[model samples]
Target: MTHTTLVTSIQESTGKTAITLALGLLAQDGDETVGYMKPKGTRLQSNVGKTLDEDPMLAREVLGTDAEMHQMEPVVYSPTFIEQAIRGREDPDELREIVAEQFEALAADTDHMFVEGGGSLTTGGIIELTDDEIAELIDARVVLVATYEQPGDVDDVLAAADRLGDRLDGVVFNLVGEGDHDELENDVVPFLEGRGVPVHGIVPRKQDLAGVTVGDLADELAAEVVTDVPTDEFVERFSVGAMGADEALRHFRRTRDAAVITGGDRSDIHTAALEAPGIKCLILTGGHRPPGAVVGKAADKGVPILLVRTDTLTTVDRAEEVVRSGRTRDAETVEAMRELLADHADVEGLLGH
Candidate 1:
């Protein structure tokens, strides 16, 4: 049987890694084994002789598989290395062939693998070995991820699609902004469709990427937790709704362990926080007052209810940055991340019985 491969590429700093992980999880839902490989990457530090994958640690957690980082990210051209190769000290084609060999070996073992390329599609034109050539070498299907924010972004993405030609399977327009999801549906999605690119998925700019706690974030960023809840038992997952008690309760229960962070004036969310069985803590973002009844219930249930005045989206964004950093590496956090990966990532789908 032919093992399929999915490729994700985007402009610089467009959160390609984030998109890859989320999609990898979605693909896993169909019970497909998803291996992750980065054929090219930004040069990251290695442990003496150990080469590591430049993707996020959470990636391995999601896939639940073990391979040498060097094998996973086989072709990383550092600045110094690039200079050397340019000066005829190193053969770029030979290096690429070696990397491709490792990639093919891994691809042969998996049912479907998600390979993420660094930056834009044709970034590494060094010695004229472009990303397109690399994709051709591996015989993988390409998926373009573009953030629908900058003017002419669609044009840029379409141009990329044109260059990729037959290797391109489809495109996924990622609306990576603080704007409404409806705007993407109304404005952006149609634009990509007109260009004949299939819209695989549209992910609204989530305030939080992986569910991580405020205390854990504070500890990581070394920022103070401007809330009442103890930092230890804080929850990270969230589904925000305009302050309605019924909606809040439903959102709270939809995910396993999460903190319901909302405005203090959102009495409905506060009430739901008090009642939610799965809630680890209640973060009242933007320093609003909780209803007396809601406060009383939270106290009685021994659930920590916190209050902060920062804007809701900003708070979540900061929290995600902190969590991704190697700040809170306790047993619980590690285990939680690992569990999430095994349950949701592409490797698990392909590997799990």
Candidate 2:
């Protein structure tokens, strides 16, 4: 019998795809015939005219799975698909049949299948299918991914454990924010274990590892880049220059490769950031371009100025979304994740070897 694991997340940005790919890599390292599948999708990447599943590509590249994208993704919740499902126009049985057929094909000549889940436990509820249902359909154990970013996270994980019950294989804590290690290691892990939720791994927060790029901010915020800088430049920190130039400069200088969000009319703040080292870019909000002197300074300092038509509050929220949506296909990042999970998670235990 082939062993399979279904990776799911309670909240977004729990590094679920990275974890799934890491497990797939571990399986390959053990000389197992690994295949990948995800029955449903929400956060997607565009391909041609059809919506392609993003998670499988990571596993495909890592494991060299022969299953094509259509087979690996199985079903993608496109806009038309969502409309059809909501209007009761699509048959749930037909979808299930399609998933079953594709899964069997992918399972052929494979010793292990790695199935990834959508954002939350209730991801496929609209289509009358849940993560548990998909796991049951494919005979895969559930691995819930959680983050210690919020205290309510504990309640969320416990609730998921209660819901999945024995189907839950283990919990892996990923992307833990700063200063919460003590609580997660001392309080959260023990509490979950006491509640019978097997805690498997607790990955620490590394800002650089989770850093978003200048191009990501531009894409998410719809900002126009005023200077041509490396769009792939990773922003490890973000700061707002709403304070005095001296105070803002102190904070900005302390952050490595940080993006400063401020009004374009704030020449003082603009000048301060331009003078600071390690400042990746400036996000000028409210549709106002910085003064020519400030623009000249930015160009001179090799900093990109991103101008957005929206107000400061809107820009900040969008920036948070882009940063939280961080998932990198970089080779270094993949190797780092593989090493992290190998040390933290018991691949051998999960694989039943």
Candidate 3:
């Protein structure tokens, strides 16, 4: 029998996919044949004529799962899918059938198959399918990933545990801030366990895990990549250089791996950034090219200079998107997540449950 583990969250950005991938990597490392599948893909990308979700391919590369992309993530909802479903043009039952079939195929010859749900428990209820319902369909044990933002957040997990009943396996508290560690260790875990919900792990927040690299920034902003300086260098912070050279220099000095967002014409800020340490790259906004001397200095310092057409504020907002997007594809981040699971997560309980 294939042991199936379903990882879901109350809302998005709770590190569901990261936890799922961590567990899958652990299972594979133990010499177990691990497989992965995401039923309803929200991060859709094209592959031939079909839409492939990012997680399945990511799992295949990281875990060495034999499951192909099409089989693992088969049913990708188009933009108009929900509209069609409500208008009686799309069949919910048919969607469930495809999911069931693909899931079975992925499970064959595998010791453990991880079923990661998108968004939340009530995510796909619009199309008459939810994580709990899918859990029922595949007989998978459910694990909820909760964000440790506030003290009242435990109620969400308790409510889900109440609803999922016997099928609910446990909970993993993710992105626990420094302030919440004591509460998670002394209060939250005890409270949840007292309420009949098992607490498997509490992962502390790491800035590196939340960072986005220069390559991703360029892609996110559609900026022109003018130079190559470790595109993989993670930018943990962002600074807008609208101040004088001395003020901007001081601000840039305090931040590590900071992306200086300024206009292309601001040679003052440009000169200051080139001389600053921990500078990931310089983002010149407003379609104005920096002076040749400034560009030469950046190139000399081996820092990439991305020239974008968007204004300073809009460019900063797009840069913020990269920070919000927690991508686990980076080698550094993968190792960090693996360490978190190794130290905190209950691997034996999660697998043998």
For TM-score, the strongest prediction is 2
What order do candidates take by lDDT, descending?
Answer: 3, 2, 1
Please tell me which model should have the higher lDDT, number 1 or number 2: 2
lDDT value for model 1? 0.61
Q: Which stretches of candidate 1 lie over 4 Å from their true place?
A: 49-51, 56-58, 127-129, 178-180, 210-218, 221-353
RMSD of each: 10.1, 4.1, 4.3
**TM-score for candidate 3, residues paired by index:** 0.79
Quote each prediction's TM-score: 0.59, 0.82, 0.79
lDDT of 3 at 50: 75
Candidate 2, which segments miss by more than 4 Å at Cα?
A: 213-233, 236-258, 268-280, 285-289, 292-327
Better of 1 and 2 by TM-score: 2
What is candidate 2's lDDT per residue for 128-217, written digit by digit as tens?
668877887777888998887767878889888887888898998888765887888888888888889988877776665788778877
Output the worst ten-in-a-row residue range by lDDT, candidate 2: 324-333
Residue 267 shift from truth in candidate 2, angstroms: 2.0
What is each predicted model's overall lDDT from 0 to 1?
0.61, 0.81, 0.82
Cα lDDT tens digits for candidate 3, 179-251: 8888888988998888888888888877667777788888888989777556878886798999999998888
